[model samples]
Every structure is written in C-alpha cells, then in structure tokens.
Target: LGNVRGKDWRIQTNVYGNGSTTRGREERYLVPFDPTEEPHRYSILWTPDYIIFYIDDVPIREVVRSDAMGGDFPSKPMSVYATIWDGSSWATSYGRIKINYKYAPYVSEFSDLVLRGCRVGPIQQVDSADRCAEAVEELMSADYALLTPRKRAAMRRFRERYTIYSFCYDQHRYGNVTFPDCDYVSSEHSRFGEWGDNKFPPKEVRRARRRSRKPSAVDDQPSK
Candidate 1:
C-alpha cells in the first residue's frame, strides 16, 4: 500500500495477486484464490539496505534499490507481518475465483511468519530517559520558574520530537480557582504570594498609591 502522498509505501501478495513487480516494468498481479481454504504464510523483511518479500519461507521478491529512493527508503527498523486482503481485482491465472455469491466473501489466512535477525533497542539513552521523566515530574510538582536549565533543555528536546508526551504548566491552576488569562501576574509574583507573606504590593497597587497622593481633587479649587 502507498500513502496518499506517493511516499512511505508497501506491497502485498495475495490471491487475485494485487501485488506489484518492479523488474523491467512495474506489473501488478491479481490473485483470487482463497488462501484460507488451506493455511499459508506471508511475510516481509525490512532492513537498512533492502526489503525482502516472502511466501511460506520462500523468498519471492527482493527490493534492493534503496539508493534509487533518494531519502524515502525505510531506514528505521520494523516488525514482520502477515495480513489478508479481500480480492477486489481480476482473478489470478490460476482457477481461484469464487463464482457464486455463496463463496463471494473469500478469506485469506496468514500465519507462521518469521522475522530474521530482528533486534529491538531503546529509542533514547537511559540518562536521557531519566532526565526527561524527571523534567516532567518537576514541571508537574513545581512552578515553571523553578525548572532548571538542564531540565528545560531536556523538556524542549522532548517536546520538539515527541510533542504529545511533553509536559505543560497551567499557571491558572496554581491555586483552587482559575486565574484570568488577562492578569499580568508573573511566576515570581505568584510564588511570593503562595510562599512569602502577602505584604509586597503589586505594580498596580504601587501605581495606585502614587496617584492617590497627588492633589487631584483640589487641583481646580479657585484661590481659596
């Protein structure tokens, strides 16, 4: 199957053959035989250099032109698979088509597939993983300003690659009630309010005090 963007593609073999061959010219074969009638296995092996298509331990096709793919080759490791597809094309040259509606719904069975020389490894280093987990825990437990530089860098890298797993801080949820987004309160202000005494005046309060001291009410009093 090919992605709609004409990239990230795969090919499958089944009855009604609906499979593609890239030798000389690209040819697609249709198979209509129901493999489910008698069990069979299908597998695909993908490596850094090539993709091998197999049928019951027999190698049928080998896709070896990774360089021709420019940068679209499947470089990352992948697992093997076996899947069935309903025949929706011309029947194979072999007599495998279901002629009547009684057998209209054909089923293909895939089993006993093997992945040769497959290996699994952690996506990131153990230290990086711990750092990422710790960063998240700290963000959840403390204020954003308390986040250390190392933690912040780790968080940034985690977010850039795996955005869904990144941590977020809800400044509005610091206390029991949600604060208005328009409020200009900084993290330091919030921290002081929560931990320190609520004696330090805010910028707005200071400005109000200065304005109150001005002679505004009697500025227009005529030479009393």
Candidate 2:
C-alpha cells in the first residue's frame, strides 16, 4: 500500500482496497520536471462514473467505473486535504529513515481554488432531486471532464515514458487477475517487469541511478 522513494523522486497515485474486494489500485511515474523549482497545477476530477488525475491540464490517468468493479470505485463524498507531513516511519522507506527536524516547519501553498460539485446536506430531504441532476449534467459537460482523442493520446505517451509501476500489469502480485477497470495496452505492458517495476528505464533515470550509487572499493583498483 506504500513504497520507499528511490534516490530519484517519483510521483504516485493510489486508490486502496480493490484487491481484497475493498476497491484499491495504484500507479507510479517519474516526475517529468523538478517540482521544487516551480509551482505546478495538480487536479483530480471525480464523477459518478469516472475519475481523472491531472498535472497542469494534462490528464495523466483515468479510471472508469464498471459493473464488475462493484464497490471498488469511490462512490461517497469526501473532503479535500493538503497534508505536509512525512510518513517515513511506516509509509516511506519502511522506518529506515525518519523526518529530520533540521527541516522543521515545512510549508504547502495553494491558489486559484475551484471546487465544483453538488452539495448535499446530511439530510437528503434538504436538496431536491432535480437540482442534483442539473449539477451532475453541468459537471459532466465541462471541457476537462471530456477526454478527447488528443488527450487520450497524450495520456498514453506520458504513461509510456514515465510510468514505472502500475498494479494493472502486476501479474506477479495479483496472480493473474487484472483489475476490471484497467484498459490494457500491450505496448505499455511490455515496458514493465513481471513484478511491476519498469523493465527498461529511460536513459535519464539510469544516469541518475549511476550518479546516486557510491563507488565500491573494488571498482577503484586500476586495471593492469
């Protein structure tokens, strides 16, 4: 359910509980750019039927609900939260690393906030059925909600180039059961190892790994 970050920082998205019939999935990718150098936009679009995750207007991943999915899709309403804490003890590096207080008081910033959805009170009688339908229609009609051919192609390219782990192709872990919602692509599947790690990392990622590794004493001896 969690992972340790390698020397190269990568971004990951997860929806838990699907494996044990509780509805969960995960995807990971090496970030295209240095996030610390500048601020970038990240957004999530969730509807009754599908969910999309975006980075600066580019749709990176989409999940569509299906009958086979059952309760795995997130159906309930939830609030948005921006957390700035490290989960090193458990989630990151499996407790090998701890948060260093030298970098205390981290800051997270947000801007241009926009939330669009039908608001329903705890009591269902507070909102009319007709009003809720109207809201749903409007949200579905928005440009961002519609992933056209171009957007789909872009998404495919991003996944091919950056995706390092995806539960959909992790046959080793799932034991031959592909998640119902996954849109299987043979070409993309070929890039991943049986265990879900990238089989052939891009040149840049390889270079980064080489740089991060320490030189062993044996390698320091000159060849005769």
Candidate 3:
C-alpha cells in the first residue's frame, strides 16, 4: 500500500524458479506442478499506477509506482499477462506453490483470468469538533459560586503544583475581595483577618470565626 500523503510504499510478488532472471525488485517466487495436474489460475490487475497479482481470487502481490503517490493517483485502464517459465533457483529457495515437472516444458494453464477497473475514495478525517464543544459546555455549566472550600483548596494546590499564572477567583460574587494572586495574600505569620487589603477577613478568618461560634472542628474542616 502507498500512503495518500506520499510517505510510504511497498512491493510484493511470488515468482520462484531456476534460471530465473529474477533481478532488481523481484522479491519472491514459487513453482507449480507439471501440466495435467489440477490446473491453477493466476491473474494480475494493472491500473494507471499500480499492479496487483492474484492467485485463485486471493491477492498475492502488489506493486505501487512512485508517480501514483500523490493526490491524483492513477485511476485509469490497464491489462494483464501470464506465461510459464523455468524459475528453479528462486522457486526452490522460496518453496514451490505447484510442481509441473511431469509435463516437461511444463505447460502452465491460464484460464478464467479477468481484469476489472475500480475506483477508491479518499480517507475520512477524525472529527474532534463535538468533543471540543462538549468540553466547553461542561466548563460553562460549572458552578463557580457553589464550589466548596475543599474544591478551592484543590484548585489552589493544582495551580501551585503546575505553577499556573492565571486563574479565576469568584470572590466578588460572594461579597469578598478578589486577590489577583492568592500566594501573595496568604501569610503564615499574619492573622487571617489582618492580611493584605481584605476588610471582611480572609476565607480562613471567616472559617475561624464560625468555628468559634459553633465550637465544632468538623465545621472548621473544608467541605468537599
């Protein structure tokens, strides 16, 4: 097979035997039994740019030409040929498909051979549009307001781990100051409410105040 993008090509064949002029591009060979033994059929289909050989309806060889590698590959007419020959050296090494020594000057039979023209279409492209659309839809439906503290912590962890520079903080919609960089605002030494320019206390401070009122460690814990 030849790549439609003109990237690769291959050749295959089976024509073995002694005294065979099998040189250059001759890859394989096979011998058949003498005439009078069950006669076998072999055929070749040639197009404007390719040649395909078949044995009893089973494809055995394919030859694609260099000129047929591009978009306008050969889609024209062609012919076929079959003849018996002494292919001893190549055939013996490759093993014989059929032996025809009994009928000296072995007459290889060729009947019911046919040639037909065919048209093949181009390959289809992968469709990623639907998958992309679905992903965008999911992102749009995500509830930034209802995001739990645990989720926020996870996002923070991810951003820190990946060294991300840009992220969305929905504090403005929740009556809290939105800091462009949370890393610069959160400090281990300062009390939660006293950090940066935040007036309503940081998220940690609100959680601490709520915990002081309820006196529950579970309440202080980030919700999943």
Candidate 4:
C-alpha cells in the first residue's frame, strides 16, 4: 500500500503457498526524501529461508522462514510484478487523502532492471523443486543475504526513528495469535512494542518489558 506525500511505503508480502494466502506479513519504511521526484534502488531478496529488503544496499528488514510457520511461509516460485493505480479507499492516510485527478497522469518509473533466478520444470517433484531453489538461493541472495550484526543495528535505528506503523506490536488488534518471526532477539524487536505478541514474555518478562530502557509502541495503523 502507498500514500501520496505521506512519506511511507507500506510494503506487504502476500505469502501465497499451496493455493492459500497468508496475511499481515508487512512493514512500513520512511524512504529517502522525495524518492518519487528522484530515483531510488528498491530491492527485495526472496530466498528459500528468508525475505530481505534493501534500499541502495542498506538492509531495512528481514523475515525468516520459521519452522513454526509450516506452510504459511512463501516458498513457491512467483513472478516479478509492478503496478501503479488508484488506491483512494485505503492508501492515503487510512483513506483520509485521495488521488487528485487534476494531476491526471501519475507515472511510476523503472530502470537498471535485474532479474536472476532459475527456471524450474513444470509440476516438478517436491524434492527436486527444493534442490533447484537451493541452488538459485545462492545466486539470488549472494549480495542481499542475511543481516549482519552491524546492519541489524542500523536497521533498528531506522525503524525506531522513522517506522510509523508495524504489525508485530499490535496485540490489541491481532490478539493472541502472532507470528513467530515477530520476536527478534535484540532491541530492534522493541520497535514493535511487544516483540513476542500477547502470548509471550510470560509474567516476569512482561514486567521486565514494562521497565525497559527504551520502550516502543504500536504507533499507527495501516492505510487499510
């Protein structure tokens, strides 16, 4: 989802696996100033084990394929797609602002395209598909692979300062069922308020979190 002049790009992952859809795996980022007026490199690295986002080679976010997720994680092959259209209902300030038709033609630009992956055979066996994707993972995730400790620190700083919305922290909205990947093992997880969702942190841990040195909260809702 997107908002005009709102200074955020709510990138979401519609993880479809085995003909089913998994929701709420999303993030929001405060990109470089006036990116639309200029050009920025927005890159997504999808591997068999994780999903990583980068803006000009700086790691912004990471989502691991946890064992707890079962088939809910996106492990299938998909195409690269981009679209530009009107989202008056749920894109601008949670439907507050909308597209102004006076600016008739809004253009989304693209250049320096790079596509690298393998071509799996149709209806390939499960084991065969897994083997093929593993090889492709080495290529696709080479430069944009796992997050280093330093990069993770930088990411935490970014989210704490600029992230306006997040799903992992909203216990009141999502209730008891939270994804396993939400609980990062560091302070970066604090940006979500409750790193482990409602069911986590036990009683003692909850008290510890309440007395945390740097607290975070579910600051804002999504556009939808």
User: lDDT per residue, candidate 3, 1-224, as tens digits?
Assistant: 11112111122243222223321223321221211324445555544334455433334434454532332233332224656565543233223333446646644455665433332223423334454455435443434222355544543432232211111122223235432212343432132222111122223323333323221221223545
TM per prediction: 0.30, 0.76, 0.28, 0.70
lDDT of 4 by residue, 98-194 (tens): 7788976867889999876666556753446665766776765574575666567666554555454556666555766767877544564553554
Pairs that collide, model 2: 16-24, 17-22, 17-23, 17-24, 18-23, 18-24
Per-residue lDDT of 130 in model 1: 50
Arranged by lDDT with the best first, the candidates are 2, 4, 3, 1
lDDT of 1: 0.32
lDDT of 2: 0.69
lDDT, model 3, position 76: 30
lDDT of 2 by residue, 162-219 (tens): 6878888777778789788888888877888787777886556435334442111112
What stretches of model 1 exceed 4 Å from their correct place?
A: 1-27, 30-34, 80-108, 121-224
**CA lDDT of each prediction against the hidden true structure:** 0.32, 0.69, 0.33, 0.56
lDDT of 4 at 114: 89
lDDT of 4: 0.56
State residue 68's C-alpha deviation in candidate 1, in Å: 3.3
Per-residue lDDT of candidate 1, residues 1-224 (tens digit): 21112111122332111122221111121111223234445555544444444433334334443344434444443434445453334222112432344544645444454444434455632234453455435433433223344433433332222111100122222334322211233542442333222223222322332333211221212332
